[model samples]
Every structure is written in C-alpha cells, then in structure tokens.
Target: MTAHIEQAPLVRRVFWRLAPTRLFADLISKSWMESVIPFVLFVGIFTYLYIANPAFGTIGNLQSISASFSEFAFPAIAVGLTLISGGIDLSVGAIFALVDFAVLFMIGVWGLPTWLAILLAIALGGVIGAINGFLIGFMKTRPVLTTLVALIIYRSIFNLITLNYSEELAVIYIEDPTWNFIATGRILGAPVSAATLVIFAVVAHVILRNTKLGWRVAAVGSSKKAARHAGINYPLVLFLTYCGAGMVTALGAIFYAARLGSVAGPTGQGLEIQALSAVVVGGISLAGGRGTVARAVLGAAIVFLIQNGLTNIGLPGYFTAGILGFVVILAVGADIRWEKNKGKAIEKTLVNPIVFSFASTPDTSPGSQSPLALNDRLKDAEGLAVGLIEGPEDVVVDRLGRIYTGERQGRIIRFSPPYFNEREVFARIGGRPLGLVFDKDENLIVCVAGMGLFQVDQQGKVEKLTDRTTRNWLSILDNSRLRMADDLDIAPDGKIYFSDATDRFDLHDWTYDSLEGRGNGRLCVYDPATKKTRTISHGLNFANGICLAHDGRSVFVAETWAARVRRYWLEGPKKGKLEVFLDNLAGVPDNINRASDGTYWMAFAGMRSPMYDISMRHPGVRLRMLKQLPRDEWLFPSMNHGCLVKFDESGRILESYWDKKAEKHPMLTSMREHKGYLYLGGLENNRIGRIQLPDADQNWTAHDSYWGKS
Candidate 1:
C-alpha cells in the first residue's frame, strides 16, 4: 500500500495537499454575503451611469442625487423597521403626504413659525402611527389589512384638506431662513438631509444590534410564541416599533416639504411600493428578523438611482417603473434561494483534508532494546470506580489523596481514599471536561472541550474564566471563540496556560481534524491579574497536552498527530521561544503531567499502524474514502492499545509501560504521579488504574510540589 501510494502521480499528491485552501468556501458562507447582491448592483449601476453620462459625475449633480437619495431613504427605513418586526406598514405613503400637507398648511396658510410647524407636523405623524400601532399591535388586527385601511383613510383626509385650502396655500408663501437652509444647505460638504440620514442610520444600527430592546424586537419577529415564553412583551414591542416608524417617516416628510415647498394630489403617491421595493432589493428579508440599517439605505439608493438615472437618460416614466418592478421580483427570488441553501453550502465544503508525509516508524516490540519497547506492566494495575464512571480522560489528586477525574457526561467525579469506594459528583459543567488541575487556592481549573476554560471552587460552583481570545485578523473564520480546549497547566505566577486542540472542529468531530492532517491548534495563556487570555503559539497539529516544567522556566506541549512534543520558554534567556522537545513518537501522545522524580509521564491515546501511516501520506485516498465509505469504516489511528512512557527534562525516554493483554486499561490518555502511585485515565475506559512505584518518593504530592504545604 505504501509503495503504491508513493508511486502515484505527483500532480495528484499536490492537488490533495492544497485542499487546505478550501477555507475560502467557509468565508463565502457567512451571513455578510447576503449584502453582496445589492452591493454589486449598486456598484454596477453607478459605474454604468458614470461611464455613460458625464453630467452624472459632477459635484453639483452628485449633491442633488445625495439629497434625493436621503429623501427616499427615510421612507425606505420607515418601512424596513416594520418589516423587521414581522409587519408591513402600507400606510407609510399616506402618512408621508398627510405630514407634508400639515407642514405646508401651518407654515404657509396659518402663518406659523417654521420651527413650530415642523414640530406639529412631526407630532401629527406620530399620532397617526400610534393609531396604527394600537390597531395592529394591541387589537391583533392583520398588519396588511389594518395598514391598507389606514392608507385609504389618511389619503382621503389629505385630499379633503388640500381641496378646501389649495387656493389659500398657493397665494401665501412665507420665506423662513430655517426652512430655506433645511431645503438647500450643506454640512461638511454634504447636504443637510444626507447628513441627517447618516446620523439616523448609525443610531438605528446601534439600537438594532447592541440594545436589549433591539434583541427583543428581533426575537418577537422571529417567533411571537417563543418571545412570549421568554418573557418578552410581544404587543408592547410591536407598538413601540410602529410608533418609532411613524416619527421617522414624519421627519422625512418634513425634509420633503422643505425641499419642494408645495403639495399636489399625487404627492407621496406610490411611495409605499417604492419603499418596499427598495428594502427587498437592499437584502431585507421579507419574512423579518434579519436586516441592517445600512442595507435599508443601500436599497433606497438603488431605487432612487434607477428612477432618476432612467429619467435623465430620456426613458419614459412607465418604462422606468417597469424595469424597477422586474428588479424587485428578481431580488425577492434571490433572497428566498439564499436563505434556504446557505447552510447546506457551508456544510458541504467545510471539511478540507490535506496531505501529510510520515517518516519510518520505530520498533516497539516486546524484548526490543528501544526505549519505547512494550510491556505488560499496566495489565495488572488496580481499577478504581470500575463501571461507575465513563471516559475519565484525566486524573488528579489533591493534598488529601482524594482522586478526581472528568467523565464524558460533562461531570467531575470524586472518589474518597482508603478503599476508594465512596463516590460523589463534584460539579456538572455542561460540557465534556478534558483536562483537570488544582490551582494554589485548590480551585479546580478545567479545559472543557466545546466550552472554554472554567473554574470550580470548593463549593462546586462553576464560573467561566474565558471562552474567547483575540481573533487572527487575516483568518477567514472567526477564531476568537475557543472551539476545543483540550488540556492545560498553570504557571507559578498564577497564569493559566492551555491548548485549544482545533479552531475548526468541536469535540465530537475531532477525528476529522486528524483526517485533514492540518495545524489548527494554538497555545494560549490566561492572566489572572489582567483577566485576559491571548494566544502565545499557533499552527500546531492537534495540540493536546500542556505541562509546565518542574523548574518553572518552560512548558511542554504535545502535538498529537504530528507525533512530537514542543517546549516553550517562559522566563529564561530563551523567553518567547518555542522548540521541539521530542520527535517521532511511537504513538499519538495525549496528556502530559509532572512526576515525583522531576520527570514527566505522557499517555499515548492511540498507536500508529502501518495502514494509518500510509493513509496519512496519501490524502487523495483518504478524501475518496471519506466520500465513498461510511465513517466507521474509515481508516483511523489504532486506539485500542494502551501505552505510557516516562521522560526526563532532556526529552529522553526513560521507560515504557503498556497493557499488552488489553485486560485492565485498553487506552491511556493521562497519568499523574502522586504519593508514589501512578494514577491512570483513559478517554474510553470505565475505570481508573493505580500502580505503586516502589522507587519513587511516597511523601510527595503534586500540590506540595507546585505551591508547598498549607
């Protein structure tokens, strides 16, 4: 098999090895990609106009466009907010016309001050919105029907008032500085209306994304029943949401009246349809609970550009309207398709397996002179809590000689000493806890597989220390959240150092990480003083074990799939330096811990087989195997055999122990030396093993070695 794999074409090997670059597929699957369609349309439309018409690019024409864009954007945003709350506001156009008439009547006919007229017009819009809010939100009327009725009533009132006062409105024209400036003014080289739109967009975005009210609105929109169950006042949220929409619409109306200073029977007509088209084109989901203020503004810009640009290019009004109508239909169809297939697309391309080259395996047969020679020493080891616990991946002993270990069921189990029969649950952390250690204060610090670092105090209360670190700026995926925190150890200065096994896969999908054979792991440290966690070293292959050296100058970390151990300097002349400590191990290394005699004991969770080694060298075969065969049939490392080894500070293997008969311990994951006994733990074993070391110090405890006696 090895010869055949090596003899395959070089081009095939290179193609398989480059599979790691498929991470781009993951980037394309993010929610931000929803804006791509609208953004592309905006850019394409703008570019076409700039190249086709010289007047479109002038500063004065651009400013006019900006003012018109702002005017249209306000109504679009007003409609978009209602959509986000799972309702449609068809009365937006009517309310806009009524507010415009109110502003014109007060300022021109009643001879009111500009400021007073603007305030009264805005208040009038709010009152109309409150009526709609009361009907649709409190009275439980269908949103579409209630808003349609409001549109008829409000439009009729506007027409009646304008019919009686048209001659009066036309005869009197009051010129006020405030009104004139609002109509045609610039702030920082931008139109006043444009500046106001920018400010409003920023505030709306923050409210929707960063506030509790915004979260409640989204929750209610997603599912009213769910929001009610979660203690959200569903009716109240809708009411306030509509009220806000009304006030915003009125503000836009004020700008429109100031710009034109007149009204007609068709003023603000068909604005509801235009706003709805703008929002849908800008990527606002029609079903609600998903959109942004920026998207709303972008959609408004697209609509305005299409209409204004078509007119400028001599297209008839009916032709421009027809084109926009078609665009809206296409946008809605695309939105539905994207919402349905985004997850499927992401899952299909998430796993990208890469090629790896393996060196020759060393001999570890019985009676061999190699330091990693197998033995039956662990076969006779005594089992503690047999059949009572599941997957005690790591074992630790406190100063009282009490045994502690983590189970696969997200629980820490404790067993009393003497006969070792008394058992109790220490803590229920709700995540598969992998590594266990006791800090100086006797708090149990754990590295939870799917969760991040946690601390369990004497009372068994769990507190999360940190779940996220600084993200890599260049990484396509968000790598800040710890995906799989596998193992950890503390420094003398109270800083906690740990290994994140893989940033890509969670605990259950860890086997995929090995199949990919890529470096997706990093070593991080959590400082107690600053309450911050930061990455120290990255690009490690399944970094599993972490053990601070006995001298406190460096730490040793195991790269499981790489079959190597690394040493990172902490305080010596080589501080901030990382180098390989041991290379080419006989098996896949797991947890590493200190021994009483100043050495470290490491567990091999699985041993490498010839078939698995050959598979690693040929990623193309593995990729095909993954696609064709069932998961259980895929070739993986040999995890049925148990093995442990002891090494000194110089990285020399002193001895090896193995359960050659597979009787007691079938797979070793961790080992700790305390009071002359070696406690064994396994990832899939139902019991903990203990074997006495006659030549070791019987009086030493790990707690005493790290922090001295209390």
Candidate 2:
C-alpha cells in the first residue's frame, strides 16, 4: 500500500496558465494609465449597455443621441471657454433663453426676415455679455456673483415677456417652408443642426488654440499678476473672452429654437448646470486655463449618452440627475488631487534608489607615484583682478591681450591688460557661460548653460548662433536642447565642436547626473558656412572638456564621471571613428586645451575618491541614495582639490601640476597656455591665476596657433 501511494504522487502533475487580460492590466498599470481612463469608462459603459439592451448599438438610437448632443454642445463650449479663462459664467442658460425668445419674437411677431432675426439674437447675446464684461473685468467684480445676478435679471425679463405675450408666443407660428425645413430637416441621416455644431466647434477650437486672443486669455487665466507684468492687457482679454463665450451660447440658442419650433420661459433653464457638469467631466479644470474645446464636446457626448442610456433602460429621472451629480464631485476631486501630487508622483516613479558598493577606490595607495601627488605651487601665482569678479570659470586672451572670462551674473567681463586693471563689461548673454572660443571672423563664440551657443561681436552685441541639435530617437530623456554646455573648441575648418554635458540635469543639479552614472551627454557640431547644427556622437558619460587636435584630424573630449579621454577622428583614415585615448583616470577631468608645443593640458575639477568610485559600479545603490537621502547629506565628487596634467598625441602622461593647499586656486576647470604663462580659472574662485610655464613657447598665442593672422 505504501509503494502504490508513492507511485500516485510521482505520476500526478499540474500546470498553471496565464490569461491575456492579466497581461494587459499589468501593462496598463505601468504606463500612462490615467490618460486612458476616460476612454475606458466610455467603452465600459457602451459595452454594458450593448449587453443589456441590443437596440442600444443600432443606427437610429445613435442618430437620436447625436441630435440631442448637438443641441447642448454649443452651450457647453461657452461654459468651457469661460472656465479656461479662469472664470465661470452662471448666465449661459439665461443667455440661451433670451436669444431663443428674441429670435422667435422677431420672426413670428415682428415678421422680420429669418436671417436678420438670427443675427439680432446673436448680437443681443454679445450686448449682454459686454455688460457683464465691463462690470466684472473693469470694476473687478467677482465672476460668480456678477454672473449670478445677471442670470436672475435675465430670467425675470424672460418670464415677464412670456407672461405679457403668452397667447401670441403660443400661436404665432411662421409657416415659411424654408424656416420649417431648417427647423425639422435631416441631412445624410443626421439633423441639419448637427452640421452647424461641428463647424462652430472647430472654429472655436482653432480660435482658442492658434490666435493671439486665445493666448492672452490663457495668460490671464494662468496668473493675472503675471499677465499684467507681461503686458497682456488683462481687462481687454477678459472682456473679449466673455463676449466670445456669449456669442457661442447664442449660436446654440438659434439651433434649439429652429429645431423645437417654440420658446418657453424655462426652455434653457438648468442647461448651464448640465453644461458645467459636462465640462468638468471632460477633464476641463475648474481652476482654469488648461482645457480644450474638443474635450468639452467629448464631455458633453458622455453626459448625453449616460442620460439617454439610463432613460432607455427604464431608470427614473431623479436617478440620472443624482448619478451626474456624483460623477461631477468625483471628477473634480480627482483632478484637484492629481494636480496637487503630480510632482511627487512623477519623482517617485522616475527615481530608483539603491546602495552602491565600490569594486575599487581610486589609485590613492602609498608609493604608487601618481602625477597628482605634487605639493602646493599655486600660492606663488599672482591673482589678477581679484575683487572685481566672482566665479571666473574659463579664461581667454584676445588679440589685444585683454583677459576675458565669464562671471556668475551672465556677463562676459574684459580686463584690460598691462596691469590687468580697468575692468569693463564685454557682452550680456543670459545663462551661465562655460566655454569661450573665437571664430575666424573674430566673433566670440560662447557655450552658455541653459541657453545654447551664442556669438558676440566687437561692438558688445550678442546673437544666437544655435540652440538646437539633432535629437536622439531612442533617448529616455530629451536631448534636443543643450542642458549644461560645458566646454567647446573651434576646429581649423571653421566648425565649432562643443560638448553638452549631461542633458538630463542643469548646472545646479549636476550631482544628480553623476549619481545616475548613465550616458546622458553628446558631442555637437555647428557649421558656419551652412548655419546648421548636428550631433556627431551621443551616449557619452557626462562629456565635459573639449579640444581640437593641432593636426586638425581629431578632437579630444573628456568624460567627467567615467574619468576617461576619448578621441573622435575628423579626417584621414580614422575619420568618424571614436577611440579611448586615456582611461581609469585619478580625477574627474575638466576642460582640455592645446599647448603651444603640440601637447594638451587637462584640468581635474575633482580627484576621484573611494566612495564615489564604488558608487559608479552600483547604479542601483546610487539611485536609492538619491531617492532616500537629503541632497545635503548625499555623497558627491571630490571637487575641492585642484590638479592639472599634460599629455601628448599618443596619450602619454608627460607632467602634472597641483595646488595641494588650494589657497590661490581650487576647483581648476580650465588651464590655457598663453605666451609661456599658464592662465588658470576655477568654477567658484574669486580671482584668476597666472603661473609661469618656463619651458613653454613664450611668444605663442592660442589665436595664432589656431587661426593665424586673422
């Protein structure tokens, strides 16, 4: 018996199967699931109705639904327009009833032509809207209170007119065939009024989306104070917006009057409530300035469909009203909550945090004999224009020997030489300017952070050279705009090669990019002859320093976080090929400049540390640190110590310089050899350092070395 039981357990087997519905649900949960909510709700409702009642999907029922939606669609549009302008109009229903009575009174009682009566009715709406506009816009009255008053006054006028002329309004019918046809005709299996609704909705959408008036209204709605500061004429925008909304409501009124062939005091009563409900349900924010007319129409359709479906299913009228009210409350509450927590939610989703353990620290072991082990010699250097500037990042000497450097205030300051005194402003280019170079025509080309590349002439006038580069198709982050443009060098062929360091973060939040340890940088080229900009190489790890070779066949670029130097060939047999020139560096390399004797000088903004190296190997750990820890407590690259190293064409380390004390110069970003003097600049130093280079070519100028006798 024991042997038989063991055999049964071995023979039995079970298999599990997964359904397609589960997979779809998981996919939707991971992506932009909120965007599909409305569509899903619509489909779910339609499916439920189709299964419950077979006739709900028939052609005739759909047509009837479309017809009813067309009548209320225009009023919904009017309410939506006001909502987008950050205001609410409570008198839309009153305006509709007034127009309906006027059109009927004109055509039936006054015997006026149908076309003229319609025009007058629309004009009356405009006139009433102008009154509301003047009081609320110019007098600064509250929109809700002003419109509520107008609603009462208009309704009272409508009631008085109907009571005084009840018999005439009841029996005064126009027998014209054209009027009758317009009111009751069908076109292509749809109501004739449906065409008007579609046409007007399209026109309104275009006006709001693509017109100056639309922009002004949006500005006012976004912030009244900001709109005034931007010179938007807020009162005028508000007045015109209200007038336009009134005209839209009048259009809907005309359609209703023509179709129904009669006017009652309450014909358009409670219509405003339904319109508001539709606008809110359609995802139009009640707080304003953020919805489209198409969304309004969609909301109106949903509301109408729900009502029609409920009635067809034998539900009571009160049930439909109560359900609509519940929906409005739920939608408004959801929208408010979404707006409040949107930033936190996005950060939580995008940020992945983990702990990083180092595979190995930097080569800081004793007796290793590294190049950055020199003592402090920068203290012996002279500080030029010491107290006149702040944070001189990159230094350049013009043909006239004026020291030009970018300041923290977005101004290029020029210090007249001889004694290095007489400081004056060169040009005002917005954003933090990082790299500086001169084109063939003596135009000062600068790579500005947050702003793109720019050119400044001799007359202190600035012009935008190029701000856009070719976009990478598969990039997870947007790389079309230069984020932190760090360094640039002009090639011999009049092409400007620049490195956009870390497109994912700006200059201030650059530590985040380092923590990411992903390739989020690119090398871009701007051609002067064709006036075009394109990206030549992408997927670089924080590409920073840039220098063109003396042979004009290759360019040297530094990857800051990766601690490597890469050579991109521009001509000869290796053209368009990229190869590593230096790897496993002791520090984070910054700006690279060509020496007078065909060598390159590289600056280390920060020497590599143990924890940072370990962090680089475990990206998941770095991500966790970024998400869980405060920025002040986060581990960062060691950017305090200053060092410089020189290399030849074959990537041989020739010599190294250091400022161990960092008393005069710290955080060395650039080191340029000009006339036997190594001029150094730092990202946050108050003064510029000039050190004597005894063995360098004393008469060689960078301008002459690159573009001779220009």
Candidate 3:
C-alpha cells in the first residue's frame, strides 16, 4: 500500500483535507444552480409563514393556496413559453379575462353543457393566441409592441361583453357536477387543478429538455440568424410557441371561472404583470432560450405565497405588491450577476486536488540492471505511414495482416502489408479514438474519447452500441452519460468491457483531471443481448487500457494516473474481484494488450517525474499551482520519453523497450505483437513503429487467438 505524506503547513493541509466535498462543488457547477437562490427564498418565506401564523399551516388554508397557485401557475407558464421563444405575450391577462367571460356566458346564457363550454373557452384563447402569433411571427412585427396592442384590444372586447352581460351573469348559477368537480375536487390528496398542473409541468419540462421541437424553440430564441442558417423554420416555431402559450393561459381561465362561477371587468386586469414577475423571479431569462417549466411553476408559487401570506398576516394590499415588486427587482439583479460570474466560480473550485502519494517506483537509469532499465531498443524501429497519420494511439492487426490505427483527425487509417506503403481511410468516426480491438465477428469495437462505445463493421459502417450506463442515484451530476470512453475489450460471452477515463473532463481538458487527481473514472460493460450498459466498478483513477486475459477468466485494466495494472476476475471462484497485478511502475501506463508469449505488453505514455511525485503528496500546493499558474506551467508527468514493458501473469517484468532519443516513437500509448513483429503506436507521434521479434512465435495473431482461424 502507498503511504501519504503530511508535511504541509497545518492550515493549508487541514484545508486540503476537505477536498472530498468537491462533489458539492461539482453540483454547484451544473445548470440547476440557477434555481438555487429562488428555491432558497421560497423555503425561507414558507418556513417564516408556517411559524409566524398557525393558520398558514392549516389544511384548509394549504388547500386554498394550492388551488390558487395552480390557477396562477398556468399564466406564468404561458408567459414563460413566449419569453423562452425570444418573444413576449403581454396579452395573456386579456386572453384570460376573455376566456373566463366566454366560458361563464356559454354555460349560463347560451345553456351550453359544461364540457362543451370548457372546450370552446380553451379554443377561444387559442384563437386569440393564433392572432398574436400571426401578427408577431408572420408580419415581422415587434413582439412587445404586437402583444401590447393585442392586450388592449382583447381587454376592451372583454370589457364590452361584460358590460352587457355582468348583471345577467351575476344572477345565473350553473348546477353542473363536472364544473363543481373541476372547481373543488381533489385527486390523490391534492386539488384537481394542482394535480393537473403537476402533470402538465412534468410534460412541459420533458418537452423542453428532451424533444426536438423544444430544441428548435430554444435555438430560435438563442439566435434567429443561426437558427435560420441551421434550416429551422423560425417563424413557424415562433407562431407555434405563441399559439401554445395561449392555450396554456386558457387552462388557467377555465379553473378560475369554475371556482368563482362569475366574471367581472377586473377579473384578470394585472395578470400579465404578475406572470412576468413570477417567471423572471423564477429564473427565466427575459432575453430568451434559458428556462424551464419547473422554474416557472416555482416562481408562480413564490409570488402567490407572498401575496396570500402578506394579506393573511394583515399587511395591506398595496404594501404586499410593493414587497413583491422589490423581490422581483432583487431576483433580476441576482440573475444577471450569477450569469456573469458562474463560469469563474466553477473554474476556481472545480479542480479540488486530493493528497495522493506513491510508493517507491522501479528505476530506469541507463546502466541499471533492473528489467525496466532504459535502452535504445526502439531507436532503430521502422516507421510505417510516416507523416500520413497523426496520434495513432493504438494499433491492431487483422487476420489478413492489415495494420489499423486511429488518427487524431477522427479517422481510422489502414495500411496494407508487404511494403506497408498503400494507405486508405478505414472509417470516419468522430471524436479521438483511443483504443481498438476486434470481436469474434471480426467487427472493430472502439473506445472514443468524447463519444461512447462504438462498433465498425467490415464495410466500415459505424454503429453506436451504447453511450450511457445506469446512473448512480446519489450522484449530483448526471453520471449516466459516458464522458470519456478510453479503452475496451470483448469477453467470450460477447459482452464488451470498457473504461471511461474521466467523468469530469473531456479529451481536451484531460490535463485538468490529472491535476485534480481524483477517482473520476469507472469500469462499464455493454451487453449486446440486452442492449444495455452498466457500470461494473466505480472510483477508478483514470482507467485507460483494457485487455482480456489469456485464460478468459480475468481482464487487465490500466489505471493510468495511478501507474498500476489491476486484474478484474470475470469467472470462476474469484469472479467479481479486483487485484493489483503490477504496482509502482516507472511511468504512467496507457494501454495493455495480449502478447504472443501469453504475457502482456503495456505502454507507458509518460514517465513519472520527481516534481510531479512531490506535488501529489501536497494537494494543497497542487491546487494553488492550478489556480495561480497558467496551464503550460503546471507540473505534470513527463511525456517526452517513450517506454514499453512486458510482464508475465506472475507480476514479474520480463524486459523493456525504450526510445531513449525520443525521436522515432515518443509518448508510446500502445504496442501489439503480431506474427513475430511488435508494432508500436503513440498518442503524440506521427507514425507507427515496427520491430522484428526474432525469438517469438512467428505465426500467432490476436485474431486467431481470440477467435480461431476461419
């Protein structure tokens, strides 16, 4: 076991000890942080009301608040929809009043059935919305100006109709069961309107977050020019958005009419202002394209609670409005400040380095007798596809002896045998492909750095096998999405085992993960029969390479940053167990692959340096260095040297290869032994290296070893 050093200053060392709670910092970096302020305020206000006024906690009062909140939340959501679409609907209040008046008039004067009246009322609101949509979307009119005029016209029409029918409607009462139920019935212990709002909120949230139409709406709102360039119908999306907003507003009107059974001139007079304040306070951006239905509902709840709670506490109505307005102003100011500083906040706190110490490692001096001693064995190795490829991180050989490697440009390059001069593009899979392997079907399975596990057929048709695994329930960030799949190998049962390098950073920012030095990696498996992926192990430190063992009962995994190889048993008595196979390596291991001699060949992508080793023991110092210095000046492993080593199953190093001059193959990431020849690949080099293995088996191939000759 490795020992940790405790030589730092007391205060700094004690402060660094709290680094594990960086998970909370990770949570703070997510988009949900935008809702934090409003949610906290809501909770504080509710707690104060519940303690200050016993009546506020009463079941009757709670039910009343729920119903009222539901009635108001619909308008808030409607206004939010328009705002999210880069537009505004100032006519929501007028539409609400008009719909309410129409519903009551139909039920009382026209003698229409309750169901028919509700449908007609909703349609009326939709028609008004359609009008606003047409004028603003198709007519190229300013949304604020168009909706303001609409509000005026619709409100005037409501006033005129109510003036003619108010007295008559005041005397008429509809004795309808459905209307009564809508007004006061409860479902599963909540008001019907409240229950319906919950369902609608969930659906709207899903639509905004997970659907294509929602994406289009957000795109248009974010940038109309960009959306148009992306072939989106901006006008149609806007029109549909406004139309949907109107229908949602009408839902609120239906519940309001049902509860009151009356309509008046001032029924929905200031509703538009209230809804605008609610959504903005709830964290919806007035500039558009950045809000959720849940936030809208939460805003409505906060506003309603303040309004009702103040009145119940004997505060005057005007004073209540004043306080609500003050809250809205504060919320808007806070939102702007958060938008400006959130990125900086995350940068300052995201990389929480922990104290990580290493045991003594093997020496690789030039004249040392150790098996891992430096040498010039790979200095004269032949280069294949020189200058024709970039960053071939891993190399694989097929049954036909064709050489395959992944390029930094996101294409697989295949070099024909014999002179190895002819080259062709094998596949154009995006993302930096890190590890390559072939299954029993001869299909190439790859681990892409940014993408997830993918398979390429014989014809080079790419198919995504899986990109996500079952999520951890307690994780703050969504761990389901695979962030950086690094290496993979296929099991005999056809299950694909892989390593996700890091959960916190992508390929480009991998250096940051190394600086943090946390266990942010995991081992996952994809079962083709179930079409599902699941995480098998968690808390791996930069899990990189994977290779199924010769016995087929275990697999070797390279924990790159930890400089160790671990064997995970897959069958027999030790199934579902992990044991360290090689420890305290001279360099950071990258990829592990099978050797023709039944041992394993592993590449050391970078050698461990004394400064980096010292820094690991002092995480506080590392954290300070990360925050105070530029990235290029940070202390890290030395990737300037290339090295490879062969190890037997007994955990003894047999021999080592090195490019001591760092000329031909620096930064070796993988090595494959095929037909008595060892092929090398590097993540930072421009070519593939080949050296003849004189004493090795001359006829063995990885293809035949995994799946017998055809």
Candidate 1 has its poorest 10 consecutive residues by lDDT at 1-10
Question: C-alpha displacement of 507 in model 3, angstroms?
Answer: 1.3
Name the lDDT of candidate 2: 0.81
Question: Compared with the true structure, what per-residue lDDT tens digits does model 1 show for residues 489-536?
Answer: 999999999999999898878888888888899999999799999999
Q: Residue 194 CA error for candidate 2 (Å)?
A: 5.1
Q: What TM-scores do the predictions have?
A: 0.94, 0.87, 0.96
Clashing pairs in 1: none
What TM-score, to 2 decimals, does candidate 2 have?
0.87
Best by TM-score: 3
Q: Which ranges of candidate 3 are over 4 A from the true structure? A: 1-17
In candidate 2, the residue pairs with backbone N, CA or C atoms under 3 Å apart (3 or more residues apart, or in different chains) clash, namely: 353-623, 353-624, 354-621, 354-624, 355-621, 356-621, 358-614
Compose the digit string of candidate 2's lDDT tens values, residues 604-705.
Answer: 888877677666555446657877899977777777787888889988777677776778787799988888898888998888889998888888888998
- At residue 415, candidate 1 shows an lDDT of 93
Error of 3 at 313 (Å): 1.6
Off by over 4 Å in 1: 1-21, 111-113, 628-630
Clashes of 1: 0
